[model samples]
Every structure is written in structure tokens, then in C-alpha cells.
Target: MELRIGCRRPPEESVPGLLRYRIASKIVKRQPLGGTDDEWVVIEPVYRAIELLEQLHDTPAQEALLIGRFSFNVRFKWFKNWANSEASRRLGLASIPDGPANLRMLRRTLSLEMAYRPGGVLATKIYMKHIAVATTEGCASRPGGAQAELLAEVNQHESERDLHLVLEEFRNYQEGVLPAGPGARSLTEFFAGIDAQLDAASAAAPKTQRNDRDVLNLLTKRAKVLHLGPANYCWFTGPSRALCLKLAGTPTVDRPLIGMCGSARCPQATHHSGHRSVWAEHADRTKIFLGQLGTTRKTERTRLQADHDRALRVIAGIDSAIAIEG
Candidate 1:
């Protein structure tokens, strides 16, 4: 059941012929074919294989066995299921009826060693050499077909998810869940204004259908100009240049980094009626703390006062913005 990497000999108590062997020259070499003699190279594809393995499965390696070797153990059946699931996910295929058998064929095609002890519920020891050979063969054989299909499917899924989220945000604005901003009165008016902006942007862009990249670009432009602030459901508020850049391209709804939030100056931040109570409470608490500070603690009191002033300014700004719209 234990998977180990490297050429170190196992304990004598272990079953005979269980250790798969490869020549040291095959593991590493100075030069071969047209290569220069001064250049040393690792003949074994361990790092590349491990990269592929990590991408396919989330299993953590248990421990280092020896030089250039690591070990981890899994139940034989679990390993089979894991391989099958990994293949299915990567290939974007429905679960095949003969997953284990297909995997065995794949291993055979790639000339990977699958040495196991003779038992009903045996544990197989798979090595880096076997994994490397199999992964290389799989990649070489498929080249573009399965991998391309997977990439396309992934892109489609992400695009759909992002589109849904943007629509949901628009819906929230329409439902009064989000605050009204400048040049918009009721939810209906806001929606109309947004539609008009989108129309204008789309007209300015090269002709494209709704789902085309050009249209998406138009939508992104409108979204940026709208400067619709964070919804009530937002978990964090901050200066969001990174978030803005990401959304300008992909339109995801990822949470902001709380510790990095520069709320006062954040372009993505908007204070609404719903957030007034929170600001009020915070300001009140900060004021109380400021009042309790003695003259000797001048530095501490100054810092608290600065925070209080910032909070009050933010509150005033929000009220002012809302009043202009009203």
C-alpha cells in the first residue's frame, strides 16, 4: 500500500521481488545523443510526473524515504477510484463503467510497472518511475484532444458562472438590496439607466452578439462606469484595484482581502442606508474609547481621534452621495 520514491533498498522483512528496480544511469546521466558533455541532467522524469500527480489528486506525500524519494500509502481500491475520478474530471467524461480496467490499459500502454503482492486485498506499491512513464505517455499520446476539450469545458463553466453572478448583482440593485446611486431613482430607473449605458457601450464597440467577447467587454465597461459598490452580502471592504482589474476581465464575485481593505478611499466601496448602523456603532465605540484616554496617553488618544474622524467623514460622504441622488 505504501508508495515510495528513490532507489534505497527496503527492509529485509519486506516481500521479495516487490521492489521495482531501475538502473542508476537511467535515473541520471551526464550527456546523451546530441547533448553537450558538460551538462548534467536528471534522466528520470520525477518532477514532471509529480507535478501532474499533484494537479490530478490532492493527496499529500507522507514522508521522504531516501534521497530523491518520498512515500505515501493508500488502499488498493481507493487508489483505483482516485485514478478513475481524476481521469473523468480531467477528460470531462461521464464515469466509465470499466474505469479500473481502462486505467490498467492506460498503464500498460505507457509501460508503467504495477507490482503487487499475491493477495485478495493486496496493497500495490507504485513508484515514481511508473508514474512518470505513464504520465508522459498519456500526455504524448493525447497531445491535444482530451486536454483541449477539458480546457474548453472549464472556460465555458467559468464564463457562465460569472455571467450569472453579474446578473444577480443587477437583480439585487433592482430589489433595493443594493443602494441607489446617482442618476437613478427607483429600482426600475436604475435598471433603465444601466441598460442605456450598456446599449451605448455596445454600439461603440465592434458588432458582436450578446455572448461574444466584444459584448462582454462592453458589459465590463458599463459595470466599471456604474461603480456599483459592494452589496450588503459583501464580507469585506477595501481598496480593490486588484479586484477591479480581475473583474474587468473575468467578472468574478470573489471576496476582498479584509486585512488589506482601505474602505475610505476604496473605489469599489459604497456606503448605503443599510451600512449606516454599523458605521454609527463603530464610531460611537471609538468615541467612548477616545473619551476614556488620559492626557498622558496623548499618542493613543490622537490615533483614536483620527480613526473617529475618518469614520465620521465616511458617514458624511455616504449621506452626501445619497442626498445628491435623492
Candidate 2:
């Protein structure tokens, strides 16, 4: 990293080279403060990654990729933080980074962070399903994925030129930016707003297209909520950043800005487990694995069925209890 930075820096200042030298010196001295702890270190990498992800999520396919990538990145970051910290590390918080515990946490955290993440995924599935259903319904009604088709066109144009420009033009024509043309406005003209008219047209877009904007809106909104930057999780209230930001007269990290998506029973739950330890249990795959096996094999079938039935009873009991409570 230092060498790369050094190569980019001016020959005179050798900014990155100097920074690397200082880091090397600090490492030799066994000082943690010398590396990432530098007071002047900027969060450029983190912000850039987030910006790129945001830019991609404006399209349907890229939005899916961004959500998946964001989920993975956030989970990886959480695991790293947990491993680095004393309290969580002792609890095996970061053990098996992509295991059930971490995946569940990521899924839960995502749902909480954006009420839309889960909803958006489900909506996307439903939309696709609806398209499939509509296709079979009748030829006339089968404008299957018309919205996605439109977005794909926009997305293609975005890749070819400026995305912001494409979006602005789309928004303007959709919002009636100009006097109605003699013929219905051409798709080409609908997307080509002059720089001078751009600001006013852009200002009117959000309100005008609020109801019509695609799933990308949900993704962008979620990204904003989570602060999933390019390289790191900047919105997180880590120890050093928290302290530094406070000193700089920034808002104090006082409350839980994000929600706890997991239940109290989750392995990574902040609360104490009712049992001896949350780690004692794992996701019960007895039934699933058993069903996949050759169930016709007598001995294996007997043993598997026994385990599966027990798991079934346990899950049923939990469900019943939850239903009664509700």
C-alpha cells in the first residue's frame, strides 16, 4: 500500500513514501498508533468504494450485485472488528467468518438497516414472478418486466456515457421538463437536457418520480442508510473514530443508530442466552440433509428419521410458543 501510494505522490513531497517510512518506523518500535492510528489519515478509500457501489446499484442487475456485495462486505467488516476487539473476540465472535452466525447476523442487520432490503428482495422476486405469470396469462397483457426493460435501456446508456446525465434526462421527460413536442417526445431528446436546464429539471425529478422510480431507489436509500463506502464501514461507531469525531465537535455517538436485526436467541445477540451458551447449538440441518440422503437405506434412514423427528418437534414447539405469545 505504501509503495503504491509512494508511486502516485509527487517526487518532491513523496507523500506516500514518507507515510510508509513513518509506518515502518512505528512498526519497528511496536507502536499500534503509527499505522492506521495516524490522526491525519483520511477515509478516502472507504468513501470511494461506497460511491462506486451506489453508482452501480442504480441498475437492476447491478443493484442485486451491490446488495449482495454490500451484505458480504459489511459482514466481513463486522467480523474483523469483532476479532480485533477484546470483548467480542473472547466470545468467538469472528470465528468462521462466513458461518451461519455471521450470515444470519448480516441478513438480520441488513433487514433492520433498511426496512427495504428484505422488502426489496421480496419485491424483486414478486415482480419477476408477476412477469412470469403475466406472460402465461395472455399475449396482450404480457408487458413482462417493462420497467426492468426500461431500466436496462437506461443502464446501457449509463454505461456508454454519463449515468447522472441519463438519469436526469429520463427524469425530466417523465416529469414534463419541456413543453410537449409536436410529436410525442423522442426517447433521445427525453434524455438530453442542456447543462443550464439540468439543475432545475433535476430538482423537480425526485418528487415527480417518487412513485415511479424502480427498485434502484430502495437500494440507493439503503446504501445511504448503511454508509457502505467503497473500502470500509465509515458509519460504524468504532472506538478510535468515535473518540476522534467527538473531539472534533461532531455529534456524540450516543444511541443505537441502526437496529438489531437478530433475535435474542441469535448466537451474536448482545443479550445473554437462556441456555449455557448460544454456541452450544447450530442451525439444525438434520432433516434437510437426511431428506437429501438415500432415505431408502434402512439403517441410516432409522437414525436420520429419529434426529429429524426430534428437530421437528423442537421447531414446532418453538413456533407454537411464538404463536401463543403473539
Best by TM-score: 1
What are the per-residue Cα lDDT tens digits for candidate 1 across 1-326? 12223322222323765433232223222446533312112223543454354445434354322223323223445554765797667977665455344444655543322222121011111222323333533433433333345568977775565544445555555454444222223333545577577677669885844444444453443343332233222212223443443534533445454344445654444456655676778899999999898889999988999989977876775565445421
Q: Write the per-residue lDDT of candidate 2 for residues 97-129, one digit (tens) a residue.
A: 444446546544543333234234333334223
Per-candidate TM-score against the hidden true structure: 0.31, 0.16
lDDT of candidates 1 onward, in order: 0.46, 0.36
lDDT value for model 1: 0.46
Best by lDDT: 1
lDDT of 1 at 44: 34
Worst 10 residues of 1 by lDDT: 116-125
TM-score of 1: 0.31
